[model samples]
Structure formats: structure tokens, C-alpha cells
Target: MRILISGASVAGPVLAYWLTRHGFSVTVVERAPALRKTGGHAVDLFRPAMDISEKMDVLPRIEELATGANRMTVHPESARRPVRADLTKIFSAASDRHVEIMRDDLSEIYYDATLGDVEYVFGDSITAISPDGEVRFENAAPRRFDLVVGADGLHSNVRRLVFGEESRFSTFIGAYLGVLTLPNTAGLDRELLIHVGVGRTAGMYGAPHLGDARALFLFRSERELDYHYRDVRRQKEFLREAFAGMHADVDHWLDELDRTPAFYFDSITQLRMDTWSQGRVTLVGDAGYCPGPAVGGSTTLGVVGAYVLAGELARADGDHERAFPAYERAMAEHVRASRGVALSAAKTLIPTSRLGVSGLAQGARLVSALPAGLSRAFLRLTTKSARLYNSMTIDDYPPSPAASSGRVGLGVE
Candidate 1:
């Protein structure tokens, strides 16, 4: 069984790793000339994802690279005195096991882990994918494989080629997220500073290991904004307008707009499809069913989805006819639960009114102020969605003899 996976960032490499371990030949294609090293922000991985990483022997590196953001200061726009919050307590209440790591770091860890075992092609992309596994690339000779998977992110090229335009299956979550990289500001080494207000919020944080920091913006909008995904100039203009008079500190942060090394902006949207598979191709992670962008536990979803898809293929003896359906079945509940939790998180984090903003700030203060035992219990009761990732249980699948030798046509592991 030979497999070709698209989008080498998070899920693509992970899926490739597991497939090779199951004795399949694997090749990964990435659009970036090399690993992307820009516009990354912190992403959380909960219990289930932690378990999977442990099985792959990458958890220790993940922990070593944790953002260590354990404290936060909230500056409410209403002139309320800033409130201090303990992130350690909030995360402990969210899950028994969790780590907040930079997206770029996480992607690199997985890519490095799978490097030797898989064939990775960078600086190229899939121009077309046929129903029978014939793939055409922009600068490489066409090749055919037994199966092709799209592990690409939100605007997956593979998804567009196979499943049609994204709007056909996307639902905007009434919000947008932007991130910028600049010299350290506000917080450092596990510290976070927030400027929160009704319908919009901004923050800056840095880690001791990083020479620079990141500025994050999350805001609510009644409708989608106008801008092309590739137009950096237009995106920067919109970002300036959105936070024009936010605060002196925010303006200071925005001053780096022209000089920042990297910037990221996108709508927080969800992908809902009746099915992720048709013929020999299927989708995984954000490419297939993104719960929602920043607010969603998309990092964890991507990890778990890749693991299950690989296990199913091995168990079915490389028969995607049997594997794809089983893979979807195993992940259905977790994906559904994650979507609900993400929606709630987006609304709560970026409130719709002044009162809502105060309540959100006070709620954080209350959670961090209580006794450890009491705070954990209170959080579990009032914020059940916070334990959203804890509700999932990982299934174990060992390498199998039933898997094909993978040397029939394309010689592989």
C-alpha cells in the first residue's frame, strides 16, 4: 500500500508517520519551500492528544517546548483596574494533562520525528487528484498511489480540488483571529497581558526561549469582512482599522505592523461536510472537519484524527474501502463535542456586550482566587466545556502483521 499525503504541517506528517509504522510506503507533499517558521501562536493539546504523542515518543520534547504561559493580567476597556489571573489553575481545571505549545514548534517536532522514515517533498503542491489515485504536481512528474489523504488546513487545495469550493461546506463562526510577530512586549516567560473589551480583545506575550513575542487579536463580527486570503497589504490595513483606538499599548504593538517578521489573519470558520470521503481520497484534520479555528481544539483534533485514520487502514489490511468509513465512525463523537466547545469558547472569550466583558473578567478572577481544590471543583461544574478534551478517550492500536508488505508496485517499508 503506497500513500501520498498533502499539507506537511501538522496532520500530514503525523498521518505519514503512522502509516509507515503500519508498513505502508508514505510520501508527503508540502507547499512551503521548507517548514513554515512564521505567524505561529500558542495552541493547546489536551489529554487525548497528549496520550497519542506519548505513544509516539514525542511528548517529552513537546513539554520541553511548552510556552509556559501561566499568568495573565486583564485590562478591561471600561477603566476597571486590571485583574490578575492564575493560568496554572485555569488549565489544571481544564484537563488532567495539557500543554500550550507554539504551533510552529509542534509542527517541527512531528516533522522531525517522521523525517527519516518518510519521503518529504517541499516547495511543491498538488495541482490535481484523480478519483483513482493519479496525482499531478506543479513541478514534479505525475504519480499514482493506492490512497491520497488531505491533511491540509482550513483552505486546503486538495479539498477544493476534490470536494469543490470551501464555502459549500463552511460556516463562519462570527469572528476573526489575527496574530503578529514583534520584539518582546507586555509579558515574558509564562506571563500574558490582555486588553479586553466588548466584542474585541488583544494581548501580547513572549517566552524566555523566544527573542520576539506575538500579538493576538480575537474579535466578533456580525458578518464576514472583505479581503482576499493572499493580500497581505489589504489584511494589514484592516487590522489597523480594527484596533485603531484600542489603547496606547495596542497602538504601540501595531507600530510593528510594517516591520514585523510575519503576520497571520483569517476568519474563525467551521467545516461541516456530510462525508469526508469519495472514491480513493479522503480528508483529515482541519481540511476535512475544522471545528473552528483559534477557539477550537483543532491541534488535538488533528492529532487524534491522524492516529485513527492510520490505525484503521492498517487494521483493514490497507483496504480504504473498509478503513475510511471506520475512521469516520471512530472520530464522529469527538469532533461533534469539540465543535460545541469551540462555539462556546469563542462567544465567552469575545463577549457581545459591556456586561459580558465584566462577567468574563470576573469569572477568570474568581477561578484563580479560590483554594486549589475548591477552584478545580467549581470550574468542573460551571465550565464543563473547559473539560471538553478530557471527555475523550484514546483507543490503542499496535502495528499489525495483517498490513500489506507495501512493495507490490511502489517499494515501501
Candidate 2:
């Protein structure tokens, strides 16, 4: 059977990798002309995702490229002194073994790992997807495959094509987030700085590679703003208008945003679908069940979903009828918990009032000064609330019968 997977980020490439190993021909189609270098934010890969990576033999390579932050500093936008955030406490609060990496880095790793075996069609997308698994390309002739998977991100073209529409499954989470690379102003020594104020928060952190820094802007909004996703120029102007009069290098960052070639802006939204599969076409990762961006579990969910889909397909000998439903059943509860945690965390982390910023800073200070043992205890306590958002290890899924199969065909058919 031949599978055409959309999106080349975490889900598509990983799914292609596994499907190729499972005796199925796999091809990945990405909208970007090449491997996407710009990632919206850094994502955490918990135990389950990491286990998947290790099984793929990319865990050691990931560790070699790990960018470990020493501490996180929280500050009021009006103040200069920052309250140091405890690194130990933050990591411990997660109930899973976690590895933090930039989204693009992970994408690159997956792309490179599967380049030899998987067919990658760049600068293309699906304009139409038939119920019988025929894919119409935006820039190429129509093609047919036994199975089609949408591993695309939040605003997925495949999901829109296969399903009725994206709005039906999308739920706005009352927040907006923007992230982009900028000049390092705070001279951070592997520390992340988060500034908070009334209904707004901005964060700056040094990246893992290239001495450059990246900035994150988040704000609480109950109403939708007229924003264009493709126009980066307008997005910069919107950001400046939102934060017109701010202190501590606000305009400087805005100026940098105007010049930076890599910038990302989006509202916090999750796709909640009743079913991930329609006939032979299925959606994976954000296209199906986005647990919200930058709130954890998104990457892990993608990895676990890919692992299960591939395993189930192999278990059923490429029969998607038996595979898709089982894949959904295995991941449904975990997806619900992860999405709920993301919604809840966004409400808690982003301050609602000016005073709330100060409160959050004090809390960070307290956590930073807590004893090591107490810090671990607090992490354990908070992690339960996070559930699979914090713990995403797939130790339960044993070695599949498909594991022995190798050198599967990746022909387009």
C-alpha cells in the first residue's frame, strides 16, 4: 500500500519513517519549498515522544543537540529586576522524562533521518482529497494512494479538504501568541526571561544554536482580531500597535521584528474533532487534535499518534479499516486530557491584571528558593494536573510484529 502524508514537520516525517519500516510505500508532501527552518516556538518532548525517538535511533542525536536552560527569569514589564525561576522545579513538575528542543530542529532531524527511504515532495499541498483516497495537488497532477494522512499543522489544507471545514473543529482558546528571532538584549546566560503586565506577557530566551535570541509575545484576548496569517509585515505592525508604549527595549524588539525574516504569529487554538479518520484519509497531530501550541504535549501527541497509526497499520497488514479506529481509541482519552491541560495552562500562565503579574513573579521567586526535595514534591503535585501533557511515554505499546520488517518500498505507485 502507498501512503501520502501531508506536512513535513513532526508528524509527517515521523509517520513516513514508521510506515516505510512497516512494509508500506510512503511519500511526504510539504508546502514549504524546502525543509522549514523557522519554528514558532521551542517544544518539549516528554517520555513517550522521546521513547519513540530512541526507537527510531534519533534520541542520542537529540541529546547531543539538547539546549538545556539553566533557569527562567520572570519579571514585570515595568520592573528591571527579574525573579529567578527554579529549573529543577519546572522540570520536576512534569511527571514524565522530558527533552526540550526547538521545533525546527526536531523537524530537521526527522527529515534527515528519513530522506534516504521516504519520498519527499516539497513546495506542494493537497487542494482536494477524495473519500476514496485520491489526492489533488495544488501544483501537480492528481495522485491516488491507498491511505492519506494529514500531519499538517493547525491550519491544515488536508483537513480542510478531507473534512467539511477547519472551523468546525477549531476552538479558540482566548489568547494570542507571537514568536520570532531577535537580538539578545538581556545578555541571557542560557536563561529565559518572561515579562508580564495587564493581559500581556513577553518573553525572551536564548536559543540552543547560533548565539541569537528569540522573543515570545502573548496576550489575552476574548475577541478575534483582524489578522492576516501570510502577511508578516502586517503582523509586525499589529504587534507594535498592541504594545505601543512599553518599557525596556519594547520598540527595539519591534524594530527587530520588522527586520527578522523568520517570524510566527497565531492565536491559541485547538482542533477538537469527533473522529480523526474519514474512510482512508486520517488526520494526525495538530490537524486532528491540536492540544494548543507551546503549552506542552503537542509534540508528544504527534509522536504517539504517528507511532500508533503506523503500528496499527502494520498490525492489520495495511488495512486502514482495522487500523484507523484502533488508533483513535488508543489515543482519544490522552488527547482529551492533553487539550484540557493546554486550555487550563494558558489561563493560568498568562496574567489577567497588572497585579497578577507581580503575583506571578513572587510565585516564581518562591519556587526558585524552595528546597530541592520540596521542589521535586511540588513538581510531582503539579504534574498530576498536567496528566499526559507532562507525561507522554509509550512504554505500554510493546514491540510490534512489523518491527522485523525492513527496507519497505516507498514507491509513489
Candidate 3:
């Protein structure tokens, strides 16, 4: 079967790897000119995602690239000293497992794993898709495929074209996030420092491996901001207005915002759809059911979704009629559970008032002061979002001849 996948990031490459292993001809089309190497924050790989990575033979590499910041310090606006928390313990209690790695590192590992086995069409995008599995691209010739899967991010072109207007299916969660790279002037080493202000949070942490520091910003908003998602100048202006005179650290970070080579800004929104498939064209990962952008375990959810989608297709002998529905059924409960956490995460991470910020700091201090065992138990008892990470079981599909053969290496030019 000839299968076409969109957005060669997290889900797309994983789907390509598994589909190719299941004896399907896979082609991936990415809008970017090349693999995106920067401008993304660190993402967690929970137990289920780790298991999938192990099966894909990339777990060791993932572990090697895991973020070294096992500690997190919270700086309150009124406090002279920051409250420190052990991130390792906090994350472990929420989910049985935790492997935090940079987003681009994970994508690079997945892309390298399947590069030789799949045909990647970079610097192009799908312009149109017909009901009969025909696809047209902006820079490539039109082609027909047995199936097309949209593993694209929140603003998916495939979802927009096949599922109609995105606004109808999108649920804004009243927040916005920005990330960029800057010089490591703070001299932080393997530690994360977060500053919390009224209804806003700004953080800077050192990335020794990359020889730079990363600045992360999050703020609350009642409604979605009106601006172009791709317009960097307008996005910077929006951020400047939202974070004006917030803190000395924020001002220092913003001083170099214009010089930063790449900057990412977007709203924290969720995509909810009654169905993710229309005929032979379907959706996976953020394109179909993104619980939340940064707060949600979106990367973990995407990896698991890609695995199940491909496994169901292989089980049904590449029959979309059977695979699509099965994929949805298997993912419905998990997706719903993950979405529930996003609502509370936004309020907790970015408090709405000065009192709320203090409350957050106090909570962190209380959690950090507890004994190791007590702390883990306390976090596990209070964090409902952590349980959602391992909510589903990944079924094993029989390996095909392609998978039994020697694996492929990075094939990029």
C-alpha cells in the first residue's frame, strides 16, 4: 500500500517507521525545508512513549539526550530567595516514569531511524486532498495514495482541508506560550529556574550541550489574540505588550529577542473532533486530538497515537474502513483523560493573581520539604494528570518481513 504522511515531526516519523515495518510504502511531506533543529522546549517521554521508543530501537539515544535538569526553582515576585523543588521526584510520582528530552532531539532521533526506509519530501506541503485519496502538493506533483495521515501540529493543513474550519473544532484554553534561545549569562548548569509574576511566568535555563540558554514565557489570556501565527514581528510585539515591565529577567531576555534566530509563539488550544477520519484521509497526534499544547503530555500522546494507528492498519491489512474506527475507539478514553488535565494545568502553572503566585510558591515549598517517600505519595495523590500518561496499553503486532530485515540509517542529504 502507498501511504502518505504529513508533518515529519514527532508523530509522522514514528508512523512512517511503523508503517514501513508493516510492509507499506511510506512517503512523508514536511513544510519545513529541513528537519527543525531548534526553537522548541523540552518534552517528556512517559512510560508508554518510552516503551514505543524502545521498540523502535531509539530508547538508548533518547536516554542519552535526556535533559539534565532534574531540579526546578520557583522565584516568587515578592520573595528574595527562590523555592527549590526536585523535578525528578515530582515527575516520577505523577507518572511511573519520566524521560525529559529536547523536542528537536527526539524528532531528530525518530527521523534518523526511518530515513533510509521512507521517502521524505521536504520544503513542500499538501495543497489539496480528494475524497478518493488523491493529493496535490504546493511544490510537488499531484499523486494518488492508498491512505493519507495528518500527523501535523495543531494548525494542520490536512485537518483544515478535510475537517472544515479549524475554529469549529478548536477550544482555546485561555493562555499563550513563547520560546527562544539566548546567551547563557545566568550560568545555570543542569537546572531550571522559573520566575512567576501576576498571571505570567518566565523561565531561563542553561543548555550546556547547545552552548546557549533557553527562555520560556507563558501568560494568561481570556480570548485568543488576533495576529498571524507565522508573523514573527507581530508575535514579538504581542509578547512585549503582554510581559511589559514584568521582571528584570524578562527584560534581559527580551533585550535579545530580536537577535534570536528562531522564535515560536502560539496559543494553548485543544483540538476536539467527533471523528478524525474522512474516507481514506485521517488524522493522528495533535491534528486529531491535542489535549493541550505545553501543559498536556502532547508528545507522549502523539507517539502513542501514531503507534496504535499504524498497528491497527497493519492488523486490518491496510484497510482504512476497519483501521480508522478501531484507532478512534482505542484512543477516545486516553485523549479525554489527557484533555481533562489541561484545564487545571493552565491555572496552576500560570496563576491569575499575585495571591495565586504566592500560593503556587507555597505549594512548591511544601512539596519540596516533605520526606522523599511522603513527597512522592503526596504528588501521586494530588496529580490527576500523571495517571493519564499510562492509561492505555500498546498491543503488539506481528513483525513483517520488512522489519525482520536490516534496519535503515539516516538518509538525509
Candidate 4:
């Protein structure tokens, strides 16, 4: 059997790793020219994703590069007072079984691990996917496959071609987010400092390696402002306008935003799909069910989803008819739980009102005073109330194969 997968970042490569192990030929196509080395968003690997990584033997290396900043300071921008909350207290509020790592580094590691076995076509994308399992690439010739999967992001071309317009499934949460790399001018040492107020929040923290700093900007917006996704100048203007006349390093952040080539901005949108599989083609990760930027479980969901997919395929052998629905059954409840957490986390963490922030601060102080074991227990219960958040158990998925399918023809444009 052969499979064609789109988007190499997280789910694509991971699915390749497992499907190849199960003796299926696999090829992955990425829009980026190479393994992406930019973007510094911090990602946490929960239990199942971590376990999958351990089985893949990449967990230790991931830990070597993991960020260790466990304390976060929530400050009132109006009063300039630091809220006394540790990192665990501020970020998770209720969970303890998470490991944080930079998104780009994780992508690089996953890509490297799959390079020897998975065929990768970079700087290309699919223009159309026919039910006959034929893939037409924008920059390549068409090729027929046994199965096709869309692991592309929110704006997925594969999904658009096969599933219909994205407008049918995407729901907009009331917010916007922008992340960019900034020079370590503040001289932070493994700490995340957040300043929140007036429906806007900005924070800068040192890179785990102390190399440079990363600035994160988030705000609640009721209206959608027009801007180009690829136009940096326009994006900078939106950032400037939203933050105009605001306190706390607005001028310096605006200057840094203009110079940073890796700036990433997007709306907090979620994907609500009733089914992830269509004919022989399927969907995984954010392409099918993004809980939005509001949810921090994207990485975890992607990793766990890949593992479950592989296991189902192995159990069902070559029959996608049985495998696809089985994969959904195994993961649907978990998806719903993870999505719920993503929907609610941002609103609570970035507290919309002064009283909310104060109550959060007081709660953190109370939690911090507990003993080690007690603190861990309290966190497990209070944070991430979702039952499926980290409750992944890798079933009997076979190991990934050593040989890849190489590049297949995508019908010419």
C-alpha cells in the first residue's frame, strides 16, 4: 500500500513514521523550501506524545533542548506591580504533566528522525486530489496513490480541494495573536514575564538557552481588521494601531516587530469537523480539528493523533474503510476534551478584567505554599480538567519502515 501526506511539520512526518513501520510506502510534501528552522512558539508534549517520542527514541534529545523556565510573572501594566506567581501556577493553572519546547526545534527534530525513511518534497503543494487517489501538485506532475492525508495547517489546500471551502468548518474565537523573535535587550534569565491589561497582553522571555528573547503579543478583538497574511508592512501597521498609546515598551516592540523576519500572526480560529476521513483520504492534526490558538494542546493532539492513526491502520491491515473510522473512534473523545481546554484556557490565563487577574494571583499564592507532592496532586486535579488531555496510551502500532516511497507525480498545473 502507498500513502501521500501533506504538510511535514508535525502530523505528516509522524504518520509517515508509523505507516512506514506498518509496511506502507509513504511520501510527504511540504510547502516550505526545507525543514523550517524559524518560529519560536513554545510547545508542550503531554503524556501520549511524549511516550510516542520515547518509543521513537527522540525524547531524550528533545529533553536536552527543552525550555526549563518554570516561573512566570503576571504583572499589572497599569500599576507596574509583579503578580507573585510561578511559571507552573500562571501557565497551566491546573496541569502538571507537560513538557515545553520551542516549536521550530521540535519540527526540526521530528523531520530529522524521519529523513532517512520518509520521502520529502519541499517547496510544493497539492492543487487537487481526485477520489481515484490521484494527487496533483502545484509544481509537479500527478501521481496516483492508495491513500492521501491532509496534515496541513488551518488553511489547508488538501482539505479545500477534497472537503470543500474552509468557511464551512472554521469558527472564529474572539481574539488575535502575534509572535516574533526579539533581541534579549531586557536581559531575562529563563523567566517568562507577562504584562496584561485593557484587553491586551504583551510579554517577553529569554530563550531557554539564553541566546535571545521572544516577544508575544495577544489581544481580544470584536471586529475583524483587513490585512494580508504575507504582507509584513501591513501586519506591522495592524500591530502598531492595536497597541497605539499603550504603556510598556510599545515603541521598542514596534521597532523589533518591523525588523523580525520570522513574525507570525493569525486569528484565533478553530476547526469543527464532523468527520476526519473522506473516501481514501483522511485528515489529522490542526487541518481537521484545530481548537484554535486559544488552545495550547495542538502539539499534543498532533502527536497523539498520529500514534492512534498508525495503530488503527496496523490493526485493520490494508483496509482504510475499517481503519479510518476506528482511528476517529479512538481519538474523538480526546479531541473534544483537548478542544474544550484550548477554548477556555486563553480567556482564563489572560484574564479580561482587573478583578479576574487579582483572583488569579491570590489563587497562585495559595497553591505555591503547598508541599511538593501536594502541589503536584493539586495541579493534576485543578488544571486541565479534561479527562483525555494527557491520557494517551499507544496501542500495538508496528514500527516505521526504513525505506520511503520517494516523490510521486502530481498532475501538472
Report the Cα lDDT for residue 396, model 3: 80
Q: Top TM-score: which candidate number?
A: 1
Q: lDDT tens string, model 4, 208-262?
A: 5738777788887887767777887887777787777666565677688867857
Q: Please write out the lDDT profile of model 3 over residues 128-202, one tens digit for every residue.
A: 998777899998899988889999999999999998888999999899999988888888877888989888899
List pairs with backbone clashes in candidate 1.
68-190
Clashing pairs in 3: none
- Candidate 2 contains a number of clashing pairs equal to 3
lDDT of candidate 1 over 107-144, digit per residue (tens): 99999989789999999999998776789999999998
Order the candidates by TM-score, highest first — what do you get?
1, 3, 2, 4
Q: What range of 10 consecutive residues in model 1 has the weakest lDDT sum? A: 404-413
lDDT of candidate 2 over 1-413, digit per residue (tens): 78899999999989988887776778899999998887456777877788789989999878766667769877787776868786656665544477777788888898888978899999998888777667898898998888899999889888887787777988888888888887676687567877677777777777557467788888877787776678777877767877777655666777787667679898888888989998889998988999888763688889889988888877766777788998898889888888778866776578777677787788667656788677656656654444655454342444345445643323334
Report how far off residue 344 is in candidate 1 (Å): 0.4
TM-score on alpha carbons, each prediction: 0.96, 0.92, 0.94, 0.91
**TM-score between model 2 and native:** 0.92
Ranking by lDDT: 1, 3, 2, 4
Evaluate all candidate structures by whole-model CA lDDT and list the values in order: 0.87, 0.78, 0.86, 0.76
Error of 4 at 400 (Å): 11
Strongest candidate by lDDT: 1
RMSD of 1: 2.0
Candidate 2 lDDT at 94 equals 48
lDDT of 4: 0.76
Q: lDDT score, residue 61, model 2? A: 79
